[model samples]
Target: MNKEKWAIVTLSQDGVALAQRVAQQLDDKMCHIYTKEKYAKQNMQVFDTDITSFFRSIMDQYDIICGIMATGIVVRAIAPNLGHKSSDPGILVIDTKGDYVISLLSGHLGGANDAARLLAKRMDAQAVITTGTDVKGSMAVDVLAEKLNCVIADFTAAKDVTALILNNEAVALVNQENCELDGVVLPNNLELLETSRDLEEGKYAGVILTSMSRQKPEFAIPSVQLVPQKLVLGIGCRRDTPGEKIIAAVAATLAELQLNEKCIKAFATIALKQNEPGIEEACKQFKAKKVIIPDAMVQMVQSRFDGSDFVFKTTGLYAVSEPCGYIASSFGKCLLEKRKMNGITLSVWLPEK
Candidate 1:
């Protein structure tokens, strides 16, 4: 099923034992346990020692860390090396006694809260979620949007609509079947009347929820457009280039394309020896995964090149390339040869219909 990777670190023997059990419960493949003198061994990968090199080495490899057993010392030792907190992976701290679960870093942003809750349930312990939005049972659209990788166009309107929902007003809109809502006034006369009006009129006061990309009919309310923003960035760079130059080119490219840094879900390019440095650097800068294609595949794709090919080759979506005269010229021949270079070369696609 391709579960997300997680790293587990523990210092005390009891902590290490608990971590091993939790790893088994979660069916995790990569778990690094820090312990002394190998007391008891489980299915998880155990690293017997407290050296800084050991901690740094594991941190560099895994994106998320689920800390179990040890709390103060383990967190203190590893906290300094965790640069760029915003981009770091989820870090959850659990008590050795299996009584409480706490999300330390990337709590809501990186799914740490979710992970902690899930782990707590397995241990029959309390999931201590202190986030106000979740506790109030109101709409947490922004948090959901981030977790789902979707774009929310109108932030102010979203908050206002959520406020209305929390007031026990029946707002006209759609919702996921599994959505959590409390004190919702469903199918009231006022909501029904507003539902028939245009969304721009501000008559409706609810959110329109759908996984599909098609726009809904006018509902006389402010709509928060929820569309997945994953994009594939196609990069063409010189051989053996430094990472800085590639990052600069990508920054310029994103700016030209009117795209956010987070919009880029992945990177794609033809396999080139010199392109590795730049590609690696760009991945780190954008926090994106790089998918390198064989030269033969690149050639075949180029033969059928369209501006969308730039994005498709990388992310399997029709995306507009960041406009760069130099980049365009270098790849123009392929695009033109395939008769794919229309006036609108770059285009972003919503998910499949």
Candidate 2:
């Protein structure tokens, strides 16, 4: 499920029953039902404070918030606690009678729009989505970015491109690297392009760029650059190496490759180095997932690349970075075969389409 933690809350007696029903439909491990002390049942949690305070208190704790009361009540309770769409939790509102499920806040990036549709199906209610792209049956750029595990370089440009697509204006799709769009059908307004070089200046209303490189092609029209997080970095470092040095080395390597650091999806290493502070700190600084490659997998894949006798003698594996990166990327394309600097060795891998 996209939302790991969900809070189903209501202020009225009727809402409590619907809230409990919603809680039943959701994953029990991730769902919690809450109501005021006067209306709360034995199974539902009672709020110790006011409804506004209770909503504000749990805003950051849950990935999704479902309100069963009036839409205005949910709005006022969440208004002060709202943040940017990128960081905010998905907010959905269901009527007390369960007639409509509304996508209230942080729709695309937060997955509220999808959640509303799914929840409405389970509740036998209609999903009320007002986003222009959804209403017009056009592709939402932010939703597409989320599906591709990408970050949009310019939010304004993304909005413009999405608007153009909704209006059925000509838009260009420039896929450079790392985005798996093999069989995916794009919007009718989007003209699929093999390269930006073929794009004529000012011909299209906007451009949707999918890339991993830091350097992108210049377009005369409004452009939205989608940088996919597809790079996996496998690292081998000496014990007790300071995190600062490891972070610097990674930054330097990414700069040399001319790739955006944000594109790093994970930091992979042998299980032995997984506990190293340097590796852990680098993962934290880059906000990437930590992938601990077991020694057996490394051993199995070591023969595919150049073997290092010294590494095998020291770590019981032929090489660390290359095998770890290969396995971490699900045995995909190897971008950078092991590069060593100082006592550290590193490799980069990208998942093949």
Candidate 3:
């Protein structure tokens, strides 16, 4: 995951210093500071004393707030303002002494839980996580797959496997070493068989079992396998398109292709023009990385195009456009395009493993 921006507010000089150290440790940008009595009036990286002004400035500048070195006063001052925004960044409180890190808001959804754990490790403090999912060590498969950018081929089998892990039961599998079993169960009895076929054919009544390879045994036993999906989709869309439309198009295309959303790793587009707010929103909504291409490349791609009235030329392979002619000519393959909407296009390109 890309590092998120943080605003650190501290009353003491020591707090400021600690905040700086934490920022450096996390490799995140620290935009402003709030101190006692005196507000340093400066631009870009400014410092302020007035609690309201400092908080207002923070509200405008950073995505997440890492409250360090300040206790009840800082949190209480900012608590009211935090309520107005739904997408407010994760709010974390760290002691000046650096003994503990607590995620005060947006703990699970906004990635505060993960951030707190990371900050704790860096600060050598305890990560105070109260989320049930983390406590149980059984993260949702869909959520995990979304965060990791991996696929869950068989949803039914995946559910059963995840359930076993959550219950902490031992599951038998071949090549267990390669799998990430952080929250999985392993069987105590490891009767080595000649082949995976033997295990697959034999029924183990207890927990889920799986194999790394695809050769199924002659006899059938219930097991789950984690497989990598090898499809990369390139997309093009009209300027100023909303994320919902693009998402709808992508989802529809994937459904048509009989593919799951987890198969997608990342998305790329020309960086020349302003990014469609919808596309940016969609990337965040889908937890997919959106890459914008350079302007010079967009111009080059435009030069090669011949057939469309809707001309959006960008250096990136994916050009957001409304015209089917332009979308078809622009991309090597027409995975999907806007039929009812004025502008939207998608192209599926498989990445080389």
Best by TM-score: 2
Ranked by TM-score from best down, the candidates are 2, 1, 3
**Range of the 10 consecutive residues with the lowest summed lDDT in candidate 3:** 319-328
After superposition, the stretches of candidate 1 with alpha carbons farther than 4 Å from their true spots are 1-3, 37-61, 70-85, 139-142, 151-228, 273-275, 305-353
Task: Tell me which of candidates 2 and 3 scores higher on TM-score.
Answer: 2
lDDT of 3 by residue, 1-353 (tens): 54457777776666767766776686654445555544323332445446655675566456667777555765776776675223556778888888888887666545567788888998889988875546775554434433333444566765665565456543444532133446543234323233354454334422222332233233243445443433444456666787888888877777776655645544555544336687787676655666554545554454443334434233333233322222223344434433333476556654322
Q: Count the backbone clashes (under 3 Å) in each candidate.
A: 7, 0, 16
- lDDT of all predictions: 0.55, 0.86, 0.55
Candidate 3: regions farther than 4 A off: 1-3, 11-17, 20-31, 35-64, 69-91, 102-147, 151-167, 171-232, 238-247, 261-267, 271-287, 294-343
lDDT of 1 by residue, 194-285 (tens): 22333344444565553223333444455555444455555554345677766766565456555555555556554442247766887888
Predicted structure with the largest lDDT when compared to the true one:
2
- Model 2 lDDT per residue over 163-196, tens place: 8889999998887764666566678888878788
